[model samples]
Structure formats: C-alpha cells, structure tokens
Target: MRSSLMRSLHAAGLIDYYALLIHPLTLGSGARLFEGPAPLAEFELTGSVTTSKGVIIAYYARH
Candidate 1:
C-alpha cells in the first residue's frame, strides 16, 4: 500500500528526495497476511523457513 508521505512527496515533485525505509527481513516459513473488506488471499512469495524459536530452518521453496 502507498503511504501518505509518499503521496505528498509525489505531489510536490519530490519523489527523488523521498525513499521508503527498509528493514531487515525476518526469516520464516509462514503465510503472509493481507486483510481487506473481503476474504484474505494468499499470493506466491519467496522467503526462508523458520522454527518456533525464530531460527531459519529451511528455504521457502523446496526446489
């Protein structure tokens, strides 16, 4: 989803000056959640598997 800050920046033609802050990704094998008015749907994404203790145990895709 687009953030309000991004919209404001774009309106002022300052897109070059704005950047989305990135954070380190958590390693895990779980479904990502996206909620809307309707039912949630699962999309294909790539990542790593994680255990109960937050340890990365395997690849998201077996192949």
Candidate 2:
C-alpha cells in the first residue's frame, strides 16, 4: 500500500495531499448441515467493509 501511494505521489508530482481509502473484510460461517460438504468458511463470504475517500474525507463502507 505504501508503495502504491508512493508511485502515485511520484506520478502526480509533489503530492502534498492525498485521499486514502481503507477496507475491512468480514467473513461468516454456517453450521454444517451435511457431512459431505466443505467447510463453512470456504462456502460463503460474509461482509466486506470498504473505505473510500473523496476530496479530503475518508470513510468505510460495506459492499
């Protein structure tokens, strides 16, 4: 992430200000209803929290 930010800064030329976006990943599990199935973790992905910054504001969101 730092590398990417650095590259972008360099490309933009003297980036004194920057907007950053962060994301949080959440996963859920379901109890095994059948024995012939894979683990619940692999079966489903639960919630995803994402962050996006605009102008000068940063926030997180679920997508």
Q: Tens-digit lDDT track for model 2 on 1-63?
A: 465555554455544333443334335754332335322221222333343622323432222
- Highest TM-score against the true fold, candidate: 2
Find the 10 residues in a row with the least total lDDT in model 2.
37-46
Candidate 1 on 1-63: residue-level lDDT in tens? 345554554455444322223234666753322232323223232444555655554322211
Error of 1 at 18 (Å): 8.3
lDDT of each: 0.38, 0.38
lDDT of 2: 0.38
- TM-score attained by model 1: 0.23
Candidate 2 TM-score, true structure as reference: 0.24
Q: What is the lDDT of residue 37 in candidate 2?
A: 32
Error of 2 at 19 (Å): 0.8
